[model samples]
Target: MSNSRSTKLHVAIFPCFAFGHITPYLQFSNKLAKRGHRVSFLLSKGAQAKVEHLNLYPNLIHFYPLLVPSVDRLPPGAEATSDVPFPLHGHLCIAIDQTLDQVQTVLSSLKPDFIFFDFSLWMPALAHQTGSKAIYYSVITPVAQALKVPSKQKPEDMTLEDFMQLPPGYPSSSVRIKSKDFETAQLKVVANDLGTGMSIYVRITSSMIWSDAMAFRTYHEVEGPYCDYLRKHYGKPVLLTGPVLPETPATKLLDEKWTNWLCNFKQGAVVYCAFGSQNKLQKDQFQELLLGFKLCRQPFLVALSTPDGCATIEEAFPEGFEESVKGRGWVYGGWVPQTLILEHPSIGCSVTHCGYGSMLMVEELKVAVEVEREDNGWISKESLSKAIISVMGEDSEIAGLVKYNHAKLKEELTSEGMQERYLGTFIQNLQGLLD
Candidate 1:
């Protein structure tokens, strides 16, 4: 280890075995590598292959593929959570758990200054054994963590009522789980007992308690109170990386097919819709969503996974869906360049499932509206159409207000030196920990 503060640090990153997790970790790695630090990214072989193209600084950021051991119920060659359905994700966690020895061996050899990880509760101990500091880096929002502060009470003892109630001294009243959504909240918060024989609550809390420091992919301006709550509860340094969005490679280009198709629409005339890769809607709900797009009567593009029980998007399409929206609507069942599409001049509004990042935009920032769901937790086509209209209608006041707010927020986030300042402070904190 070097004595000076300016000396480059070696950092290791091993996030949970999901693309949702891996993608963020890799983005963080890119930031570190951009700052002239050496980063060793520990992940499964398959995950490495899938994200190899995303490694912008291959010279400084290295991939060390861990050999995921065989586990019963985990399909052959399945290394990441995306390789199988959600229910089988537990088995993937088990496989990841089995890689602890491999990770330790690599850590010992590399002798990094710090290791950043989530989900692997045993990582802090390994880091200690290898003379490295552990940073429990959470990709989840601090607001969510603050809602369900971990307790010594076992998972079996926790009730839905327990989860519904926010933690003492919780921060925001605007960000809350409604009583109707208590069951879903409970399932996500404490009931998630993965294949490692540990609930997600226990895994995260234990990791946070043991790690040398904690980090989040957010800044204080966004979630200051929630971050403070975690810092006070855990009594550890809570560092922020801001939003570590990866810089697009100069050589990368949007696919020609997408470019050609989007060119047909006028400026700011098309609505783009996509749920995340992991979200597979039921057949009925899928058709309802497509019908909602048709009801909106606007040019739209939908890139989503095939609906459950259907082999292809075409098979699940509503009767005459293609005919009703010919030349205007396109439904694709594969990945597209999302960032590029969002930047396209032809795109006006986006309909999403409110994944972690976008949820803040809808709920807290008030830059987007959520489609109302029925008591049965299903969204009606009319509700979706109404939400789209509220944001897209030229004369609508809500549309104008949200658009102005979104533009202001975007400008602040992308302003010169904003990201640099966050990353600079983050690196200083890491060095301070070592000192």
Candidate 2:
């Protein structure tokens, strides 16, 4: 079982048909390539185009496109989940499922040593057929994954109570879903049959059971207990990649328009809000979010998708809202350079949807505050304003504490050799598994 210490492995990554998932896989691929390994990134043709610029090491990491087969109800030429609405996502999954034979063909030809994948339950079997090892690479947090582990009971037969119950040997109780979120959690468990006759729970659990090993884009310091719980539950090794973030390209520059607009504000004076791609709020909720920024009475920039059924952000604004906040606030409907915006000196607080990854920051690291939601799961403008001010307020103790803790944790995560050490161990584990 001994492997040459200098051996360079070939790895293939096939993430789900979503930008959030695809982006992380590419980041991880960059990490692997940086370490002198070759990577074949398998994705849909359309998806490949969107993320091509992110392939930092094109020579070492190649993009291999797969043709997405036509499925009923999926928009013509829609390959990734971002191309269509949320309801049509299941059909997209069906389309991805139909590409299994095509993937098998590619894998057989490449014959990579390892194939990293998520959401494709058939990958393990195909990898075995192609003489490759399948690693279940999850972009989501281990806390969420551990919570959603499939039970012995059938998915359709599971109730809200059963869905709320934490998996046996789960490490943290505070991280469990709130009562208000139970309905959404229930749907994920019982009604997430992604048009492939397999619930999400089934897809995840099956992937875990069949994959050669499980991998995560996290470090032991952040998720050690959850990783341990998963390892014990699945009887397999769990590899950690320590948040595989690619170095920002030097050639990439922030657009001048954003730079000019942000310079109008003082240092740490602007509240920047962005809900990641795929979170389209209803028109009313979107307007409420805008009004919340107005209520905060601070300089702000909001970059969000036009709300559902709204053609433009202007039309969705509340009455007099445009004029009232014209000088100090800007609402943009298109994508902005989020990383640069966050790095900008004037940008103060970031309001986000608290996606799976950020949940750890709020719940575990205590680096951010959660905006209180109404009974119906909608965030009121007042609540949103309060949350923003709490962090941005000059005299707020919570803001000071969060900033200190966040800075301390950021230093630890970004310390010299932190990522390299984690990645080195991870690569060693990957080689060990093949031994």
Candidate 3:
């Protein structure tokens, strides 16, 4: 714990099973533990093992079991949305519903000072029953909260095009979804319930309603207006808890093969590309992206997430594709240590899904120039190549902006001291209740 004088409170965190959600919650748990607070990280049987392996704050944090109920179509050990196909996400939500009884029991017994949850809409009510303060710790942006569907509009009635249209109360016209990027079929399925009883949007709306306060995984400098909008829209206190930054592990040499591979490139020369865990690109789009990287002929490292039952990387790759880009690029299947890669000297830019976790890390480092796939959704081979070249090309303006913005954001995120200060305020606010 830092020497900062204060009170310590027990904080319980219940993150969804996905790595995107789990990583931030773990970081938040570490942050609270570092402040000399006891943290109970409630995990489903599936997520517990993976999280325990991370060896984060072993002494400060305690792990508790939350059962993931058996659901049809979902594999036995699967608890996270990332563990299954994107289409199966609703099933995971249904499985999460099973945890209600277990969570209530464990939480009531532990009776922590505060309980933090992600996407668990029932948590706030559970916290209330247990005499614990509840905070909805959102990993996604405030945009979801800013846009509210009219009472008359049912999600089932809305099409992908309808969803793409800007919702009421949107602060700007700049946030509309693009045609290519919108997954109509997949989203339509997710829009309706898969035995979860409530849709994902309903879960989000209800969580905000039942919580004591809302905590966002963003800062005022970047999304102040949206945060302000959310406060008014929800009629609740919204706390912009600085981007929950992950601490670099001390022993990151888990994979020496990639470590040696990355060191060969010049400083700020390699393009690091990874679309988060849950996003799945059709085979054609994946090939186009690969061809684009090959077209640029730059040194790059791309991590591709193969679908749930895909045979191998070879199955997904174009014939002879690996041989063609052998020296210039490396395409790996499954998990990549993004933070370690970003910290590498050879890393120059990242082409990512623009997931908040990835973006916040890139912004914090201010090192890698980011090219988000979500910016224009899907693009042709030529456009994809152009985007890569725009970032990698010598004397390109985009490269310059990447360098400048990285430094500026890094300074702002650190120097502003918002994360630490906001966390202190959060503790104080909760402490006041006890007083």
Per-model CA lDDT versus the true structure: 0.86, 0.85, 0.74
What's the TM for model 2? 0.95
| Model 1 Cα lDDT, one tens digit per residue, 1-435 | 445657799999999988888988999999999889999999999889989988989999999998889989888998887678877777787888889889988999999999999999899999999999999999888877777675434534555566666666777767656665524753564655766566777777788889999999988887888899999988999999988876887777778899899999999889999887888999999999999999999899999899889988899999989998999999999988898888789999999875334556777888998788876678889999999999999999999989998998888788889898999999988888887
Rank all candidate structures by their lDDT, best first, as comma-separated numbers: 1, 2, 3
Q: Candidate 3 on 100-205: residue-level lDDT in tens? A: 8988888989999889987888788889889898998888877555644423344435444555556666665555344543334434553567567776766766
Q: Note the residue pairs that clash in candidate 1.
A: none
Q: Considering every candidate listed, which one attains the maximal TM-score? A: 2
lDDT, candidate 2, residue 300? Answer: 94
Q: Tell me the number of clashing residue pairs for each predicted model.
A: 0, 0, 1
lDDT of 1: 0.86
TM-score of 3: 0.87
Sliding window of 10 residues with minimal summed lDDT for model 3: 355-364
Decide which is better by TM-score, 2 or 3.
2
